[model samples]
Target: MHLDQLNQQYGLPELSFGDRQRGFPVIKIKNRFATAEISLYGGQVLSFQPSNTQADLLFLSDRSHYRPGKAIRGGIPICWPWFGADPDGLGRANHGFARDRLWTVRHTETLANGATRVILSLQDDEETHKIWDYAFELAIAVTVGETLDLELTSHNRDQRPMTITQALHTYFTIGDIQRVKVLGLAGLDYIDKADQEKLKQQIGEVTIQGEVDRIYQNTAPKLFIDDLSLERKIEVCNRNSTTTIVWNPGMEKTATMGDLSPDAYQRFLCVETANAAAETITLAPGERYTLGITYRLL
Candidate 1:
């Protein structure tokens, strides 16, 4: 767990470790272009802000508890095996267990491009086997630079095939949730999670009038978060991902969520890259699947 030797070997101050409440390890990376905080508890990225930026691009709730087994309220949460609820009518935790388990840090280095790269791995244990009954290997690789790159790979080690749905649930800091417009989901049919999972078509760019939760399928690989209030746009480039989810708790639900800050709902929006709903992924023995997304400001 010591990085001093690795740091001296790499010739840079690459990684520093600290405890996030209750003695859980958190890794901090200071690269040439940006700095980030990653929690090994769930391989969750808690913060990422580039150089010379006043505010972070990712929104992390100040009210979030840094306890074990509870997922943080913001940032990039890795949702795997299942997205929203139990897929087979069994009562399991919402959004699976990957975000709750501690992951092993496999590699950390400064890349040739001067970017910081960190790799983490997690495998099924007795607890996970009791819940999901699947043997698999999951790895998350994140590259920090002017732009953020997150890639998640899942490999099946079992003799049988299994299906799973996942998402890189990302919370982005916005100037105002009421004024931000989500582009690139227009003209696509989506499953509206807010309206009893009704099928609907997005007539134009998305506007959040109330609480919204929709899953758009077969979407374009590129999306944009045009923040009119901030006068900045976030370009999102994705690969090997079929579904996109847009969510906001709005005024009412935000009051009910205990983990969110008092004004958290008004300052951030979630535009997740997903393989969920009907677009589930099936992996055979020895097969691997990767889902990746990159975010940058323009």
Candidate 2:
């Protein structure tokens, strides 16, 4: 939509348009309770902070490129069709086209409870068809307030069944990565990506010391991230998510990642709500599925 149309449709003093470095468009959201920033390119939420809080609940990398077609390094990035690598090994982009393509702002609403919600959408196109060959429509509805909620819905338009894996790759700011503790997933089995894909059982809370990337299967709907230094707990609850992914690049790996600042590894933690690996989703024609995630500060 054009800038004038956006301003007209939204018709709110709290919602405005702004551009970042390189002139990429962004939507700024602010109300009486919380504030957020959404980039139209990926329907990505870059920052979310409660009105009375001192820190942003979400994190964004200072060095992340704001150029179009590039995934902004942090916040909540939508990983769809596939996750991580090309499942069929045809050398497609790492996390598919959803994050790289621009999404249309469908509409905006103010809930009765005072939360601001924005909905964005994307559908199959020539570019996406070249890579995945699937007919589908994706919509992401984000609600911001004392809590941040994202509901990603997918509809299968093809006649046959479709199998897919996905994730809401969320980066949460923390006082210190080393002093963080993630709970829930304690007895679940996870495939350790960094440990050569070996399946292991979790005995207790998770604490990171080195490069860690694991997809925990059959995870509970609710989990918690306890930041010792910040003295805050962020509760993550999900629906239609069978897998939870926990990843941190660590010191050595962060040094080689150009998209991230050199010391970026220490400022945030990724706790993803996912449907991945052996927990893939099979959708019949005309069927729809939604991955719902709610982040509440406790």
User: Which one wins on lDDT?
Assistant: 2
The positional error of residue 228 in candidate 2, measured at the CA in angstroms, is 0.9
| Per-residue lDDT of candidate 2, residues 1-298 (tens digit) | 6777777877466777777654567788898889999988888889999888899998899888777678889999999888899999888888877988888888888888888889989999998889888899999999987789999999999888888899999999999999999999898899999999999998899998889899999999999999998889999999999899999999999999889988889989999999999888899999999999999988
lDDT by residue (1-298, candidate 1, tens digit) is 4445434443247677767666567788787799998888889898888898777889989888777778888889999889998998889999999998888878887888889888899999999999899999999999999899999999999999999999999999988888999999999999998899999999989988889999998899999999888888999998998799999998888988889966778899999999999889999999999999999988
Q: What is the C-alpha lDDT of each candidate?
A: 0.88, 0.89
- TM-score per candidate: 0.95, 0.97
Residue 240's lDDT within candidate 2 is 92
User: Over the full model, what C-alpha lDDT does candidate 1 score relative to the true structure?
Assistant: 0.88
Q: Could you give the C-alpha RMSD of every candidate to the true structure, in order shown?
A: 1.8, 1.2
In candidate 1 the C-alpha lDDT for residue 52 amounts to: 82
**By TM-score, how accurate is candidate 1?**
0.95
Count of backbone clashes, every candidate in sequence: 0, 0
